[model samples]
Target chain A: MLREVVVLGVGMHRFGKFPETSLRELAGEAGRRALKDAGVLPRQIQAAYFANALAGLLTGQESIRGQVALREVGVAGVPIVNVENACAGGATAFHQAVLAVGSGSCDVALAVGAEKMFVGDTGRTIQALAASADVELTHDMGLQFTAIYAMRIQKRLASGALTLRHLAEVTVKSHRHGCLNPYAQHQKEVTAEEVLASRPIAGPITLLMCSSVSDGAAAAVVCSAEAARGAPQPLVRVLASELRSGAFRSGAGEELSTAARTVRAAYEQAGVGPEEIDLVECHDATAPGELLYYEDLGFCKPGEAGRLLDEGATTIGGRIPFNPSGGLTSRGHPVGATGLAQIAEAVWQLRGQAGPRQVQGARVALTQNSGGWLEGDSAAGAAHLFAV
Target chain B: MTQGVFRSSTDGEGAPSLAGSRCRYCARVSFPARPICPWCGREDTEPVAVGRRGTIQASAVVYHAPIGFTAPYIVALVELAEGPVVFCPITGCLPDENAVPPGTPVELVVAPARAGGAPVFQFRPLGG
Candidate 1:
């Protein structure tokens, strides 16, 4: 039988543009912090997984990414694995680390995600992000990821399922949450009018509603429950971890989205429902994405996500607080580092260590992350459930 | 302007049609024609023309363009007559609410994807 795994420690380098910092410096800081938090020596790490999505395209760093970065923090001679799954790269790395410990392959494993997008050219960064899609089919269309979200939001607006005001309100909420997060890139709260008036990037999607180009890193340490019996940090159990890829569907069929399917599998594995989830850190690359995930994650009935948000059920201290860490829109999306940052947020909240943004009495937390785009859906989706 | 994605009229007098693949096993159609059927995992598939005429399912006006693209251009997802939905640019209109809203009938045409760029398949409102 597989052994139970627990998160021993987590850390994050502040999420924002860091022109003066190198990718190795960003990753080294987070890794060192995690090791220190776990009170474990660097030599104790049995395996390592490093996640970086755009390094090859932006910085020209191809292979041995994990080994190269981890070595700066004194991690070496171990099975260092490099992971790249677009934006979900961090979660994929964490999943592998958990599996390593749970399957008895090792007692301790490390996961780190880092990205450097501020290469002095905005056009180059945009081009690299667009490569996450099926380039062959979409390269010529001048596709921007924001436009994909805009298309979805436009359909919902056309159907009257959502309104322009609701979109603005969500952005306002994200910014407000970001204000409480020290690591957030856009910490200043925005008003609904401000959000609406911000420069429009796509149909009904203003600049404030989208995640900005950012550079940062996040790291986590996982060990078998037995290994964590006497650990210093509060224990956070890994109840479930699920990853899934998009399935091709023709027409407007009634198939569940990739996010929905992945979360359903996680729920079944954890033997818990959405009602048990006290807090969440979902992939809100755009403001409307959070609203859509409310339904996709089974938090509410179809066509009622907007109503759920209106009820204030997703704000801090609400019934099911979401993105207490400001989500991608405000907390910053460093592509590869985003998923691990979600993990760091969830762990802090579960331990009651989250200061101002803490979801009071939070016992169970869930994180949902997705990456890339394919055939009208995310190419990969990952969901993990944790409890204290 | 990827090669083999679409076919132009031999006489150069008609609109281009997207080249897709139809599975001989499950009859699933995929745009940008796959060598093997995504559904049924069968290699028995044949090239077919698609998206000659379609209805706009969703659309957006992109104000922040990527490299080689101008800002404030319209992009859309159109459901073809054959069943596959293709993402392409929508031309012959301004970026506004009335710019080819969902459900508007459209037809495919070959146009420059960017200023002075190679021709790629795009969509335009029927009779616009």
Candidate 2:
């Protein structure tokens, strides 16, 4: 007996480092655009759900971030819920909004994710951000994300399942897609030899293979079908949205499968399969993650992600175009805004508004986001399916 | 200090053994103590030291440095013969793919880490 939720509008400020813009300002811009797109005024939003991770750590504003950010946009006195799920915070907020709409609690809800990540020294800022990781154990082991994932790369290479070229192919393809996306953080493409020649951060992972920190914001307006029909344009129905936590609380096994579970469930709830998906905006925090996800999400068989990349299956023109919005690799992972940005990409394609990166006739779209690291995989995973 | 599970320093057994938590609920184990069962989230658990023995499940040789660490290290997934697979750095030998393959038997050793730093755990060839 779940109520149907429809996306009336999606909005995003171009993704990049915007030091002149405050967190609240960026969020306000996105919110304003979304409201306009939905043909609603500021007074129409019934509630606000804000997703931000490092605002407290980097900005020293711990509590009431949602209140502070949204109140500045002239939407005061409504219930404002702040969600912090690390990198997945944006997607998590969207999930809560979906629940709010699906449960018939609120007819119109605004979900916004924004982060300002370039205010200080980049390295120190990244270290402070890493504070979200399991600090005590990671400190003792002296392991950073690069170190942990580098070990995984080494192990996989040792298995003779992949090569450095395969990893480079991942970067090359992402850059190729980003070339057509003006909003991407890194638009310049690179050759495989250049990737191999780049400096190594951790063993086997190079600077070219890693994503950098930046600032951005994305917002989406969710309302019931009744409300959406009243808006200016046709609506994209939220078919199914599901979130799952890490299977292993400590130490890592089954992380890939954890995301897969949410995908399977979302497909079942949406009554669609891998083949029916037109595009996906997924978490590609690193090159290896994208490959693992291809297999994890059943787009291809296990260990075939490398082959998939080599064969041009994940590019913009592929069977199921992935990360056509440039992905985290090229588009920049601005933490809170990433999930809503994915939704925005899907909405743009559904409405036939994407200028160049659009997947033609995209009717069904999927977004997968993985949050903080737990035992061996992400502690939280979320997936959402939308249909036009 | 030749790192092995030890008593207090004055008692002269070297550094203490790395302690972990074992599930009393359903026999699942976790390295670096977990308060509740990862599988069931139950509070029923006990602290136990995996004895100085295990087999390597996977091994990787590091040619680059980790944060706060030096290069030329070995990281391995070791499965205690009885139960539990743990991630730890292997010392005393370069863990190239050929040096320690999956199922290679290893014996725990106690030793001072990196130029007389804190005593830590490492593994070596059991027969050697």
Best by DockQ: 1
Highest TM-score: which candidate? 1
DockQ of each model against the real complex?
Answer: 0.71, 0.25
lDDT of 1 by residue, A55-139 (tens): 9989999888888899877899989999999999999999999989999999999999999999999899989998899887887
Question: What is the per-residue lDDT of model 2 for residues A175-251, given as tens digits with 9 covering 90 to 100?
Answer: 77777877778888889899889887666777777767878888988998877765787789999898888666333
lDDT of each: 0.91, 0.76
After superposition, which runs of candidate 2 have C-alpha atoms over 4 Å from their true positions?
Answer: A249-256, B1-15, B34-36, B39-43, B51-82, B85-128
Cα error, candidate 1, residue A107 (Å)? 1.2
Give the CA lDDT, 0 to 100, for residue A253 in model 2.
Answer: 48
Q: After superposition, how far is residue A159 of candidate 1 from its true place, in Å?
A: 1.5
Worst 10 residues of 1 chain A by lDDT: A248-257
Q: What tens-digit string does per-residue lDDT give for candidate 2 at B1-118?
A: 2322232334454533445678998888766667887777899999876636788766666554543456666666666654555556676566454677777888776554355345
TM-score of candidate 2 against the unseen true structure: 0.87
